[model samples]
Target: MINISQCYSTGTIKGVSKVGGLIGFCSNTTITDCYSIGNLEESPGWENAGYAREYLFRYFGGLIGTTSLGVITNCYSCGKVADVPYAGYTQYEYHGFMGPSEYGDENTVASLYFDVSKAGRTDNFAVAKSTQEMKQQNTFIGWDFIGIWRIGGGVNEGYPYLLFSYTPSEGLNVFIITDIGLKQVTEMYLITDMGLKKASQSNIIADTGLK
Candidate 1:
């Protein structure tokens, strides 16, 4: 069994058949303390977008797709899980927590929650909670608060973050430029114990010595 914990996804993942926001397919797996803040769309491609037709089976889950011989605990998804509006003979098996749990004897999923307003379905597969409930710590039972995770203060905004990123001192400053390319001839400033150092790199990874 595969054990997954303290992981999250914030980007859109689109696909069909055993598709999920966290894992596309799962069997004999155990997932805990995970979340997805991205949209999970099934059959994203257009019917006539160079393809003949969409897949006949579209099984999608907010956190995990088709679960068989698996266990999911203390996981949540705040993303939309549904099939795109496409005119075709496409089948859908979408769920808030997981796609149809086929083998009830082998698969066990508990404490799975989703945003009621965001997620369209409120089936027994996963519990539905309000947006306010998601932000509160008490809402999630058996979650690690001291060692593994922390919340608030714009880290994950209202969500919890991994403890490795926690800092008691001043936080590190990060800046990004979308237009910049590798070896594009640009200057950079780095902070060192000595002082602010101005340097440039022929390659992004190579050091150019302190100045």
Candidate 2:
């Protein structure tokens, strides 16, 4: 398990088998405001007893190798990850933020952003910005935004939205608005499973609006 906050990593792995930036194998960790730039590759190794020799299983990833349960927020990754030349079936997967292999894993973002323009090149990994203020602010364009989900550029086509499954007994019941524009507006509605309720002007608007 690994917990990273505000960091960056990059490089190339020539013959390494299992490789990753933030983590090779993760479990129950939290990563925030981080970035990864690199190319992770698998080298030729001893073939497993049951596995075939022709197909090499290479594990290469950007943010993580395998995540069972964890939380990743406000992070991004730009790199070329290739799992080849190994002695098994290769699974090549990349993420601008994180790589999750199981359910119940939480990936959250509030004013987070990512640029994967060079994802398939150079094997670069970097955290360009560490603070939430670095993201370009805009209005929420009506979409799902929540926990254990991904929201940002590249995958979501630059449309920010929360993604996650619902679990009632987790924590406090609070509505969170991520858009800076939405937080600036005065009139808004509190949406819930039951119905929509008008939010107080003071509640929706920030302190600057109050003045």
Candidate 3:
């Protein structure tokens, strides 16, 4: 029952096996309008690499390690995929965006894409595009631009950014405006699924000089 809507990752993810930029392992879930652009690296210092590969399941991807029995749409990933280069004990699987699944493939995903330049590999798991193509808005079709996503305007380094993109660790959506002279931030708003709520004064993260 895992459902992730309009979420994204802009950092790094490290793990031994079943590692992913967004989700490690998922099933029967629905992920839409999501993406990840973080370097995925293998974490050393564990049991035997071979032994662990069987136990941990050597599966890595840019968005999800493995998934099935679900739907994914309008999702993309642009990150470097890394894993145990010499796991001879067992076989390791890696993909630009996703790995194995119970009953799904490229058909199960609509408008799913991955950046070949960044991920360093391309597979049939998802659509592969160049770095420059990824930055273009036209590359992402059948996506909600006005409501869910925004690109350009110096947003996310030309990458598509969710209109309300914010992880739980980032507190909440605290946008800056010019109404307050653009010199300081004295306001904050809590964006909920229902709608935007005028957050209380306590929601203000900071009210000081901007520059």
Candidate 4:
């Protein structure tokens, strides 16, 4: 069992059974405050256990292929899920957030969300919302915006960005005047195309000190 949180994926994932954009299979694990923004391209099935012909099995999701005694909460996926066509098979199965919940009781998963307009899937386990709705901060009921996440301001293409990706630089000096004493904090400087800039947790302010 493991706990994963405050992360996201922006790459493609491809496989057969137990295929997903983020994690193929999860067992007794807890995933929270994560999302997948890449595409899930799964190939047609693989060789069956004993049969010579290739066949596709259950379990394929945009976020997770299968959940076995696991919990996923406050997580969402906005990736398109599709399967490559197989010559012999006519039926293809796919999902938006998760393929199937093979184990766990009723409280295993909670507050899972997905973008219906982006992922192009609707499943019972996920609450679907439009692209615009996903961009809004209020769409996520229990998410922390002040400390753990950020919206807009040229990050994640309007999607929520984890605070880990928005850490304040440790090179710039900030002078703070207090009743007790004065404090100066060093901040990291970021050289961008615009010019030298000071990066903070909320925004990046241009220094404009050099041409």
Candidate 5:
């Protein structure tokens, strides 16, 4: 399966529809300890102007637009979701955590949270936390602080961050989402312009330039 671990997205992510701050769409993958502080908003001057707002899906999400057969855990997002116009569209839905899943099941979504104050709204897939509560360590009850994540100490406005992003070690790794002509499979191989390579070999290669 595709493994996305300890990843995050920042800044504003604007689009016509189905916009996700971290991932626009994914399926059958495992995402853990990830977050998105980026804002999700509908692109200006691009709504229903000669186009039908009746598109099958019109959504904006903090982490993912739609994920099916996926497992998400220990993830959170504190992003603003706004400027979407879908007054009469039945499929119009937005969320601070997720847009939708193929099976419409929330079982695969676990340990997920969102800052309602920043997001302005939320969904059933994730729990809502106020801005103040999001900054407190006690708010994340079962999160790992000693290893994968850390909070406070003037970091991320006290929001949790991946530990390896701050500390230098052999464990530091960064996985770039493949853009291999839009076709992807739930496999361990990363096929890029540099040629095919195993996911394990990619993960073990240190990013020594991190500072």
Candidate 6:
């Protein structure tokens, strides 16, 4: 009743039956990097006009009939599907990306973000450094995350409480900011191979030192 990474087709068959790129019916399986492009409509056997029932009982998707156990990642479809009306069937069915008959299983997805500065819209979700023109002043101020830079004075209080430090065998110094306390590090003046150097605590002192 369940299969993983498999492809199937119910060639030229006509009826109130099921067909899909992955499986006619799904159970405990994972489908990744899969796709389907075809036409699906209600068969003469059923009164329903669409390819699938909408309300409940019946579900259909372009790539899969139902997903229960497996995760579908990096998968997409460009197919035409429609639901039709019949005399006996009152409940409608779904057309695209239908779920499994039951809920609760192993399903997860990891999405990628694109760097638009370098390659523009054509870039396919690649990680790249920011250009000089894109680097504004005071980018990384109070942000706790690695790749986020905060500028200005609205940083949440109680942050950057210096945690434990250790030097690995390769002479790489690792510093963890465990507990975030009030009074965030306002500005990061410089960052080099050594470490990050903060700006003055007070604006007045920072201006005085600059002069």
TM-score, candidate number 4: 0.69
- Give one digit per residue, the lDDT tens place, for model 1 in 131-172: 777766677676766666555445554665566655533332
Q: How does residue 117 of candidate 2 score in lDDT? A: 48
Error of 6 at 171 (Å): 51
Tens-digit per-residue lDDT, 1-211, candidate 4: 7998887888987776677778887787888888888888755444534534343545667788777777788888888876445533322356778876655434377877787787776666788888888777777877766566666544577677676775334433243444422323445457788877666533444344432
Would you list the clashing residue pairs of candidate 4? Answer: 169-188, 170-187, 170-188, 171-187, 171-188, 172-187, 172-188
Give the per-residue lDDT of model 2 (tens digit) for 53-106: 432333345656555666666555555565344323333344343444535455
> If scored against the real structure, what TM-score would every candidate get?
0.68, 0.42, 0.70, 0.69, 0.72, 0.37
Better model by TM-score: candidate 2 vs candidate 6:
2
RMSD of each: 10.7, 14.4, 9.9, 8.8, 14.1, 17.6
lDDT of 3 at 197: 60
Ranked by lDDT from best down, the candidates are 5, 3, 4, 1, 2, 6
Separately for all candidates shown, the number of backbone clashes (residues 3 or more apart, or on different chains) is 0, 18, 0, 7, 0, 20
lDDT of each: 0.65, 0.45, 0.72, 0.68, 0.72, 0.36
lDDT at 49 for candidate 5?
57
Model 5 C-alpha lDDT per residue in residues 1-211, reported as the tens digit of each score: 8999989988898876677889887778899999999888777777445676555336678888778788989999999876556645423477887887745655486788999899887676889999888876677768876677767545566677877776323332333333211111223445567877555433534322232
Q: Give the TM-score of candidate 6.
A: 0.37
Q: What is the lDDT of residue 127 in candidate 4?
A: 85
Model 4, residue 61: C-alpha shift (Å): 1.1
**How do all the candidates rank in terms of TM-score, highest first?**
5, 3, 4, 1, 2, 6
lDDT of 4 at 151: 65
